[model samples]
Target: MTDAVRATPAARLRGIGHEFMEFFRDLTQRSPARFAILIYLSLILVFTGLFSLPFAAEDGRVTPFADAFFTAVSTICVTGLATVDMATHWSPFGHVLVFIGVQIGALGVLTLASILGLVISRRLGLRAKLIAAGDTNPLRTHGGPVNEGQTVQLGQIGGLLATVALSTLVIEAIIAVLLYPGLLIAGVEWHVALWEAPYYAAMSFTNTGFTPNPEGLVPFEHNYYFLTILMAGVFLGSIGFPVIYALRQHLFSVRKWSLHVKLTLITTIALFFAGGVVFLILEYDNLLTLGTQDAWDTTFQAFFLSAMTRSGGFAILDVGELNGSSLLVGCMLMFVGGGSASTAGGIKVTTLAVIALAVWSEAKGRQSNQVFGRRIPSDVLRVALSVVAWGATIVALSTIVITQLTKADLGRVLFDVISGFATVGLSTGLTAELPDPGIYVMAITIIMGRVGTVTLAAAVAASSRSQLYSLPVERPIVG
Candidate 1:
């Protein structure tokens, strides 16, 4: 009788735990978007606690909650915006935390959530595949007749996950190896270079941009080889994993590339050159920026700045010293950001490509947006539009709130706000000066931006109720 009574509580506890896990598993299958957000939020909170510890800081004192929380968000979001000095503020422990946090963040939240779900469920079933597909294929979220050619097939989800993991490990390892010699040439100690190499590789590839040294990029400003490696890492990361996977499978054969791959590469390259030229024109004579350098240095720096503005966040120039026109240009580049499912954030390169193609089609009076011999669907375009609308709204609202809180200039506020919203770490010296309230608001913006516009919208909508019958279409007045 005594043994039976003692075992009852244990059995009851096990039952409760089982029920809780089942509920979580169901949530993952039903709403992967929310599951992702939940995971990201939980991660941020956990990191926040870690940073708040005394040992996390260089000084043997517990860090302020606000600063810790912001850093946590920035690190996990891979945004790199920091209220505290990233270089000198933390101990080796904290830096390691940042490194791990970014790797987790670099794994797309949806992908990570799906991975967790897979582990918990112990199998990649049809529903789990749909969850995984939500990451590689955003089209899966809006249930309809999906064109499988446009997305990673459900069967390929396992391969996609493998690609994501193998690519991240292999690419970052290669980047680290490339950076090791550069760090050595830059006069870093052999032992220090060991750590700095992988650290720089992670920061660049993740587009997190947190420098470990107190001097930041000032020492390596003249080291074009090192800078080029950084840029290369950023480019690979910003291009998105799906694009990488496609290229890996069909590198020599350009004909096999998907529309997403073609558009991402073409648009990314176009923006790279366009932004470089524009920056050269606007800041070529500005003494505070590129003017002080010689012609060669100036031109190189201009391109570097252009690359950095594409959500790389590794700044060779003082972003705050740039001309007003250049800042505006920077804002536009940052807002567009990198490709979808990339470590880099923003509306995404695909979004920009679609919108630009749509605009071009409209100008040509085409009935459908067509590109690279493939017809762009209306649904994809609609999602692109929604992404832009939500992104703009987030940026606008963040700018307004932060501006009011800081009483800073509109231009600076807008620049930093977009930087945070786009998860670009480049700051106009304003992000560091923000008050606590502004920090919290920026944190929210970073989370929203990193979570993604479509995912965020879906999370809010919760359950999608497909209409049984279509409503009669009514045209509103055209703009």
Candidate 2:
């Protein structure tokens, strides 16, 4: 009987090995973004599985499985929406899991994995280069013979990743150090102040916005220096890394800025100021700000902080206290999100810029789209349109579903749905009140946002094809 049982186990092991090998083979040929999502999902599963153990929550108390899974997904996606409060509910072990997940999500799973592989093998191949190019949205390659070697240099990859990580750490560290004095003056213990400072720094820069303290920044809300540091970190994180790199390069040579770099910087600045002004105008009498006696100071702080709230989740005032119009505006900014190739999520400012430029050209009766005196390629416009269309569809569907499930106001439900899809993590206090199914929907949206709507749509729509014939073009209609 023992021998027969052992044989059965051996057969099962052989079957598992074969299945694993086949899966690995298929994944290697898949899109790198898909593979990256798989890696992130697997990590989340593992972390959640471990947290399922009794020792994972606070006070060694067993947490509900749903909460653990939800928390895992939230952290891995870098969406700060929590079904439960982090400060009171999660143990230190769970907090560590959240921290690790946020770091990986912010840096990107594939980028981190590629870095590890490069360190181990000390080489990157042509396939890897193509994947990296796709991930970064570089200009399409001219049709030419491909070389297995000399396509992408590992040094460039390492340099960019290292630069982003180092820049984030240095900026966050400075903010943490600067914040310590304010925290200490607020009567917080030195040790608690030190710990919370870095925690806030990491949360703010990663745009996770998960605060260690229950009151959030409300305690230091009136402190100008504290708000300044937090806002700076938030703004930097929302700007795309490629833009930052380009700006850094141009700083050394003022006349050599790339068109894309120039457009991104201008759009980002314009959006920030515009959003700030609109927020000031709308919320001038709302309880979160103007209801207080220091209306001018409150208005200025609200406007500036509202701009940061688009991508980063730090809120100076209570989000629930905003009026309907203010919430609507906030939702719009969150849906538009920050720049591409950065910690921020959404359709990206570049995509919005491209679409806007395309619209302007069409209205002018131009056959070709142009931006900043440079022709915008059709392929780039197609990508931009696809991202916006797909993102809108997702947000719309999720909003409908959540509205049905939660019976919340249509505007607030749509706002939360877009917030999730953009990975903006700002809620009008609806996240905690969401039902289980609603939480799952938001979780899926977060994953889609981080992976990118266009990438996800492309993965689903991908097919093998050979172009054999060209169709004749015909004009359809006039506006």
Which candidate tops lDDT? 1
Give one digit per residue, the lDDT tens place, for model 2 in 1-479. Answer: 67656678779888898797656545544444566666778877887786676767777877777777878877777777788888777777777777777877777545654554454335544455455544443333321332313123334665666666777778779878988887887778999987888887777777788888878777876777777777777777777665566565566764465555566667877888888888777777776555664766766676665666567887776677778887888887887888776777888887888888888998999999876556767877877888888888888888888899999988778777777887777777888898889888888877888778765754575553679999999999976
Off by over 4 Å in 1: 1-7, 125-128, 138-150
Tens-place lDDT per residue, model 1, 1-479, is 67657778879899899999898888777777788899999999999999999999999799999999999999999998999999999999999999999999999887888788788766665665775776664545443564666678888887898899889999999999999999999999999999999999999999999999999999999998999999999999999988898889889988877777888899899999999999999998999988888999999999999998888888878888988899999999999999888999999988899889999999999999898777777888899999999899999999999988988999999999999988999999998899999999999999999999888887788676768898889999998
The 10-residue segment of model 1 with minimum total lDDT is: 137-146
Highest TM-score model number: 1
Task: List candidate 2 stretches off by more than 4 Å.
Answer: 1-30, 116-123, 138-155, 461-466
lDDT of 1: 0.89
